[model samples]
Target: MMEQNQSGRSLLKQMTLREKIGQMLLCGFHGTEASGDIERLLTEVPIGGVIYFARNVESPEQVERLSKGLQHIARGRGNLPLWISIDQEGGMVARITEGISLMPGQMAIAAAGSLEDAYEAARISGLELKSMGINMNFAPVLDINNNPANPVIGVRSFGEEPEAVAEFGVHTIRGLQDACLAATAKHFPGHGDTDIDSHLDLPVIAHGRERVERVELVPFRAAIAAGVDAMMSAHIYFPALEPQRLPVTLSPAVLSGLLRKELGYEGLIVTDCMEMDAIAVHYGTVEAAVMAVEAGADLVLISHTAKLQRESFGALVQAVESGRISEKRIDESVLRLLTYKAKRGLLRMDADEPAAVAGREKDNAMSLAAAAPEQAERVERGDRSHLDVARRISENSITLVRDEEGMLPLKLERTLVITVATEVTTIADEQLVQAPTLGSALADCGLEVVDLTVSPEDVASDSARLLQAAEAEGVKQIVVGTYNAVNPSGDPQRRLIGRLNRLGKPVAVVALRSPYDLLAIPDASVYVAAYESRPLAMQSIARALTGQIPFAGKLPVSLK
Candidate 1:
């Protein structure tokens, strides 16, 4: 067993009720630097930490300064250095985009089929983050993507199999924690197998207790065994766990009963963004925050809006004073939070005085300026190595699921490429088109490229019309690239490909996002699941198509 640190215990003994309550709340603020509003929040509410989103990130230097500024203010107020957190889960959900290397996400790593690759990916990500002053990363999603129709967690998960998810998730946690960056296994017990996107609406998992244990909870249990630093609760409702239909974020049956007692996870328990529609549309933000803390969440995340943060903070104080929430409950979570900070050496700062804080800020600025080039050099070296892994992984992950009549290694000299821009929801509920240009990837290979946008309302007829026009111009080889075609609106692309097949033109389907798109368009002459459309993946796809690199990838998830 690990020995408890004296600093955390001593600090806990000295904290007032408001400070302890503040420690439980993870609040969000705007801009890249500490603003007046943020200073006010630190002074009044005095939150435990701040969560950064895409809006808060402008550049790597800005982020380092922003984090240091926040910490400087916190130390000035005689509090523990704030836990600066972010959702840097690469691929679609990367917040720090400019300086950081874009990873092929969880599914690609799983597709690469190497635990070392998973570990390296996390290590590279953690190193970049630590240099930038961010301490915590919400990543290595343990949710197994067993359902093809799952809206939110398709590619974010490692794979469909529980064992693969567990293996990769454990390696990822070790990689992050070893680099001194806290890794959070998220959306427990699991957010997979649901067709709904919880950001827009609440999803319910109808699995019975036995089935839940057999499937959804498998990776979570493995995460606990791996000594994950934190676990983020899902807003999804699981009827088998809680018959009252309360989302797991507010259910003691799942959070306390299942996660704590049954599964034995001793790390910090965090609630997903309370501003998301799953919680916000159903209940008031303050009510939900109180309930989440009551349900055993050590941290309640309010990712946006100052009004909601104030209300939630006020509600927690009132609840503690009115005896609605016990002081012991607050202390339990505060102790865990402090221990985590101490473990990260956040509590190792010198004497907490105004002069000390000012000196620390000046020292940080000087040190950061000096360290910026070294940090940039580290990222440059890491990026080179990581991109090589990405290329090798991409080369191996482009699974040839179906190829009838030997249509692959296409005769690119006579090919016509059509990229279908479909709505894909990666980071938010609002769908954005997968806009990677395939023409450039295949340009040097002598393939003709045509970009076409098909609305969901008229995907079939419009795509067919475009294909017919290409055929009229004597284009025989058809290559169709699609995004989000597997989960929801797949039939349109399938129909368009089928129409080309009927016309005696060989069609090769490249699944830009999900590998399971082959299930919807099974009859294509050839199909390649690229898993993700990162530049390296796209380049690999072009190479695979023209026989420059062999299709070396195997399917991580069974299409059948």
Candidate 2:
């Protein structure tokens, strides 16, 4: 029998210098199909993993085939099994949408008021991803949502409190790992307190070491203690950690000294996408890749730009040969990568198999057999039973911040549903097309729903026209779907609400995304914080509006 304790060194000894360096990169490709570039990438360059985005995904079947095809190529090329990763964090940052159950985001789980629920949501999310052969999820964001103006992480966070974040994040990590998937606690030390989105530009976190340890590092410490498989570095600059204000992705002090030595995180450290402007704007792609590895990141994530990926690979190869990067450093990361793959049964390929057409076909057949059950169970995961959890959680997350006039539970008559979401925006990706709005759900509840779509800039004119029509139709009340009413774009919604109030009409405002919307538009007669605007959230809002369900959820985040 083979030894149970096969050392990483044993695996490292079998690899060439080029293969060792190739094991550090995690890249993303353009097409849905297995193109020649991707084939070459897996066979020749042989990156450690590939990350998927909405652009690369079309359906569950497509993703299954894509993942299997990539794995087939990797196995056929005598490479270690690829780590197929995605940001399947549910709510907003979900890459696999159509066939997966879109559960509420982190804050919603926290707001649902149960650690068990948080774990279950993650378990289901992991199940859905693993079914598609995706082994890594860049999820369970350990960031605490302390900043109201946080452009990227609002609902993506668990809550504003560090303890709550730790409590929920730990369970979430357990859930993902339970399903044979690796859970990644991300944006360390923390990206929650910043108001800027790092994708567009770098944001500086000017906290002292004391405050940083006290607040920002709380959940990350908890995550490490919980035994998370991976942690993704944030691109935000920490002035306290390094006087030069280097981003954590390129900071040895942060990644090595703090996360590794201080926190004692033995798992893999994956960098946020190198293609983001936060890193790419300052250091060139090749320079950034070299620096990330030097900074102690086990994996450098370059999610797009194939040209930059090739350049980065060449630069790493040159750096290793020129003694700029020690061979030992390369071995250290490769060991971690091999050890990780070994644990996940990725290194269990047949030795006698040829690395050609026969091998590829056999691997493809095995993958298809494994993926069939997963695809079959896809619809089952989103069945009525699972959706009930969403409904219950959504209803539980509905925080009633204000209802002074108590205009809720409006009778099913002459109620105009004015949803002001001409275009929805999320930090992950700009959603050009609006999803099904709350008007349809309200209409399902027997209310006379007058759905009027309006861009934030056009809200004034749109409101005027809509209100006039409502008045002519003898509409008695208004329900506004304030998706991002706290954003600068929501100025027109505030104006429209003011106009409606002056007209002596009762307005029930639904804060679709963030609970901070209540702070922005305080004058509304009735206020409900749905925490999300997904269909389940819409159903919860509908139920809450018509008095079908009670507002049982406590405010996870402070409105003050």
Candidate 3:
């Protein structure tokens, strides 16, 4: 340990301001394999890490070659091995594919009712990541989906409660570490309650310290207790913490005072992408980086811009010399960082690879998801899945919550239904669509469906009038299926279903998106969940509704 200490100091003394700055910015290298501009950037920019996006991948065999190439780039920066990282959260957010076993989203893993499942997935993910020459993964979203209307989180969160997320998040972290890739628990201080998308605009979590400590902070706290190597800050703002309305990424009160002083999280603290609108709209790139660092961010992520990295680095260097940012503080971060690198066993690896293989993705995701319980449940439930319950509370769950007496199933086969919603643009829309699309399927089933549409500005009036018209036509079943509205329309949808029920017609509610929407329109006599808003999912729901297929879907997540 004494000799190790000496070597650490020597290395730190030799690093230039550019080298230190390079260690902070995590650049993204596009291409199947690292080469050309990637090499130049590694040598000149001397970045500390590289984040892989879908554009950088092909097959898993190619991924190993890509990783080896990045190791080559790191040689120019004093032989410091670059942290090769990917967003491999599985289920929608995966980068490395082939050979590695893939699991469904966190909810599926949590639903598996076993921590071992989470560990196994993370272990295999880490093992594959390591084999491909990558060293880190941005995974295991720890945010509790306390709010079902949250579009960005959905299946990404382990579950709707804090305890479940904490249990699964810890297991996942252990698994990744077991595989040798440093696991990251992300969007620190929580991104669960916001109804605005940080990618498009700034969202504020108005809860004070008490609320944050009780719920949103649980998973992160558990992660810290487990000694996770790092945590990623969110781009969303928490007004209770800062009066300036600064995002957690730029809030010293959060990173320094709370996370460090209260939680004792001594590991690395990384900021989410600085290129995102949450930070960009508020501050220039330079100011953003400076603020992030001053606010206690150990690694400021320059996920997109090479130029912005330069500006941020220049600003930090200036701050150091001018006494605005102390070198001692910088040194503390650098030391912790160096320790992280050492812990990864980088000093032992040669960082050269012409023989690495990467068939992990193909083997992992497709095969594993196909064999998983979620697939089995999907097969069982057919189209009527995701009831926010453990079992098929099925026909019983289609409650007439507000109806004085049950309305009769409509008598007319010539039912007119028009769809008016589109894909969700952001993840924070309060209302989530639970039923699958019933348009073409409705037509194919020989129902004379009359479709209606509503604009964002005129949706309320439009939906109201459309229901009235359906009532006027003596329509049998007015299917209210909207899979694209990602806002909190729980009250409105319930109220609408109530009106349609009063018309004394059978109302079949289909959710093409999240099953959580079913909770809003409890009065619908028959409810079908397609489990997704994809066109295929929509088609599947219609088939299931008409009894073409028995609804075999089991609840993968609990909505309550």
Candidate 4:
């Protein structure tokens, strides 16, 4: 088998530089079919593959055509075939939204505490990807989210523990690979600690090598053992790996030294989006591309950089001719790329029935649409006693974070207050509140809520003006939370939290969208996270606010 594989590698070496470079580039094709110049480019440039997003694909039938389009290009570009890929990792990142089983994300699988569920999710996604002509899935995020302050990968991770991500992620990779779709574990060595978003700006991991090995490398190690077809490097920089240099994507120390030599990852090493700020914002396209290849990358991903792709390909061919980048090195990656296509049966253009594909495509979209609503169900069916616990927590947890003057637990008849949000028409937005069923049972006996906007910088800047308007209506205890659902503290939430915190009026903050919102604002004298902002849950909050129910909800995870 090794001899046969070697022979296959030798054959791929005979291909042209253009053909070799084509196998290393992957692009996204929006809409169901690849058409016009894009289709022409696929055949002319013979780029490696396509990555699909939810908008580009509607049902499985569309994906079949999309895949066939790429395959058609491949068949036209001599004998080599294409590799269609997507981020169909289930849950939020799934691109196979057309006709497949829409399983819960890694979080749900982790919550279910079942490997079988994770495996089944992967298997179903793989079957669907295969049906659509997709041979690869950029999935099974191996980041072990250990930081609560992490802005991005929260529930997307399997769980907080490295072992859990490894355990559950392994099962998912195995299942996807078994279904004949190449599964990629990413963003390597990890992207779980930083609060920064790499999509916008580069994030730095200041951790030393020893510390990273202890925590961050856990999931990737397991992924390697699980036989994943590829490992995607992170955009994060590890100084310990390179001493003072490139992020993992362009760092030979991390890619060739650690991943290849130390961990022994023989499979493909695909870089995360080379167009991301970490790569593009810093280095010139030509320089970065050359450095990436020479730094030991087998497949470089340059999403959203067609011009860079052209420039980089031109540079690599020149490098080979000029003895700058050895052809032997290029051959190393080409052989792997070609063998992957062969193993994928891409060269054969399997041409599975279009009718069978059409049926599955419709099924996939319906399943994904059905699963989107499950995000809410997680809390609704979460704890049967959530209402009672919410009641208790809201009532008791309302301690003054900093009551320097001790103006708290407003005396029922003494303190006057009003609330505000979006639904209320204007500053004239005053309505005398009746005691809610639960509120009527508590100390103050009355709870009032008015509506306003917590979005855009302007609304946030005018927060004081808006809140003052409510205060002028003879009010106290400025209770604000309804804006939780709409803006949830991008600009609006932050503005609201800032105004309410500085109000010095015994303000209370209630956010029920993501628990992360609580950490964003100053410690509210009364902070309540209803988990979700459902009206029914808000009704429960009214009761809890008035001491009608005692606060009993324990912290799911620490707010800090």
Candidate 3 residue runs with Cα over 4 Å from true position: 1-7, 76-79, 96-100, 349-513, 519-560
Off by over 4 Å in 1: 1-4, 349-382, 422-435, 445-465
Q: Per-residue error at 320 for model 2, in Å? A: 0.9
- Tell me the deviation in Å of residue 503 in model 1: 2.3
1-560: candidate 4 lDDT, tens digit per residue: 24335544545545567777777777654456677646756755757676666656767777777777666555544435566777765543455533454444555456445576567667666665676677888889888776765655654577667787899899999888877788999898898898776765678989988989988899899999877888988878877778756888888889889999999987888887777777788886577778888888888776654567677767877888888888788877777765665555543222231111112221111011111011111112112342333233233322222333443333453232323232321111112122222222222346343334333335656766776655554555555553332223355656555665675667666553334456666555566554333233355555555655644343333456
lDDT (Cα, tens digit) per residue for candidate 1, span 1-560: 13334445555666678888888999888777787778888877778889888778878878888888888777666555788899877665667766666566788778778898788778878887887888889988999898999888887888889988999999999988877888999889899888888888899989899998988888888888989989999999999999797999999999999999988888999999999889999987889999998999999999888889999999999999999999999998988987787566565423232122222332211011111112333445246876676566667777787787798787744566777654546444222325456656776556765545455457776875776665775676777787777755567776777777787877788888888787787776588888777666778888888888887777778888
User: Best TM-score goes to which candidate?
Assistant: 2
lDDT per residue (tens digit) for residues 131-209 in model 3: 6667778888998777766767765677667887899899999988876667899889888786666776788888877
Q: Is candidate 2 or candidate 3 better by lDDT?
A: 2
Clashes of each: 1, 0, 44, 26
Model number with the top lDDT: 2
What lDDT would each prediction earn against the true structure? 0.78, 0.79, 0.64, 0.61
- Higher TM-score: candidate 1 or 3? 1
Candidate 3 local distance difference test against the native: 0.64
Worst 10 residues of 4 by lDDT: 364-373
Clashing pairs in 2: none
**Cα deviation of 363, candidate 2, in Å:** 21
Model 2 agreement with the true structure over 1-560: per-residue lDDT tens digits? 12312445555665678778778999998888766677777766868889988877888879878888888777667566788899888776677667667788888888889899888888877777777788889988989889989888998899889989999999999999887788999989999989888887899989899999999899899899888989999999998997666899999999998999989988899999998888999887789999999999999999888888889999999998899999999888887776666555455434333223222332311121122123324435465666677667778988787788878787777877877663445548434335577888888887887777666667766776976855754788888888677877778888777777776778888887878987788787688888777777788888888888888777778987
